[model samples]
Target: MTDIRLFQGPELLDHAVALHSVYVDAFCAPPWNEDAEQAIEFLGSLRVAVRRPGFTAALAFGGREVVGFATAWTTLAPFPTDRCYPRAAAGLGPERTVDWLCGAREIDELAVRPQAHGTGLAADLLEAVAEDAPDGRSWLLTSLRSPRAMSFYRGQGWTQATHPSPDGEGIVVFLGPRHPAGALAAQPL
Candidate 1:
């Protein structure tokens, strides 16, 4: 079994950097690397998610080195709304425009080191996050173009939602029992 720990303070920042590095190696997506500005943005988002309430960051270590990390939250704002609030709430009254956000769990981000990519580390990281969540529907968004990524969710039995990516690209949402094997129902160890 992989050892996991709850991240605190700058610990999240450290993982965010590791996550940034691995993301570049795995995807080479422009925004993930070769773009200093984009890398900064990506790291900023990761740092934010790790610090949010009900949000937990899990890092896996191979004895002495931090090989991978995943971060998620117990609540999420609905799409369009979730995506827009950070932009639209610039001037609206907090009691008004912000009221729409309530009672939603969000798996904001998850990334595994390229060196540890094929070791089932990603699934284990997600499983740990799910294990900590209270019984309830949860959701995550993954690139639909990446069949491997999509398959990973399908294996976990995530249901497809109607929401499509703003870019018109496929993006599927998943909400299901934390565990299909019934292991998730067991008492916390």
Candidate 2:
């Protein structure tokens, strides 16, 4: 059986190495194909991310080994310009970006070790971090390159808010099930 725990603020750093291992296991293979440098960079970013307002994280452990994890925080106003934030904002436009995303809970990352893929651990971790989201306003951005990931979130009831390019090779934004603007998303062709 897997045990899941929630951590808030910088306290999450206590298990940094273990969490990094789970991250590498979940993302460095197959469709993701991320490298060691990217994993190291994630560690560095986690340090800063944990300090963001409303930051929360959930980790799944099996016999003292981390098998999955998820992180989230409240999105602030003006919207960010870095990372994939710009892509999300561009897709939603300035008005919806601020009105729908700002002040909402933003799920930053969710990863489950390959061995734990079919065990429902990913969904548990996602809910653990987002359980307290304000008004159930939550959102996330995922790569369209991974059809499995896209399917997983959709199966979890998240609504796809952004339409990917014809080649389906870009970031796609998803609004959590209860997001007020979920009905505003454009249906895919």
Which of the numbered candidates is closest to the native, going by highest TM-score?
2
Each model's lDDT comes to 0.57, 0.91
Model 2 clash pairs are none
Name the top lDDT candidate: 2
Per-candidate clash tally: 4, 0
Q: What is the TM-score of each candidate against the true structure?
A: 0.68, 0.97
Q: Which parts of model 2 are misplaced by more than 4 Å?
A: none
Under the 3 Å rule for N, CA and C atoms, how many clashes does model 2 have? 0
Q: In candidate 1, list every pair of residues with a backbone clash.
A: 74-105, 75-104, 75-105, 76-104
Candidate 1: misplaced stretches above 4 Å? 8-10, 29-36, 76-102, 163-168, 179-189
Error of model 1, residue 80, in angstroms: 6.4
Q: Please write out the lDDT profile of model 2 over residues 72-142, one tens digit for every residue.
A: 99999879999999989988899999988999999999998898998899999888887788998999999
lDDT of 1 by residue, 1-189 (tens): 467776644566755556777556555652233465655677777766666767777788777666766677755343235553333333223442223223435565666666776788887877666665555545566655666776677687654432344463445545445523232222213
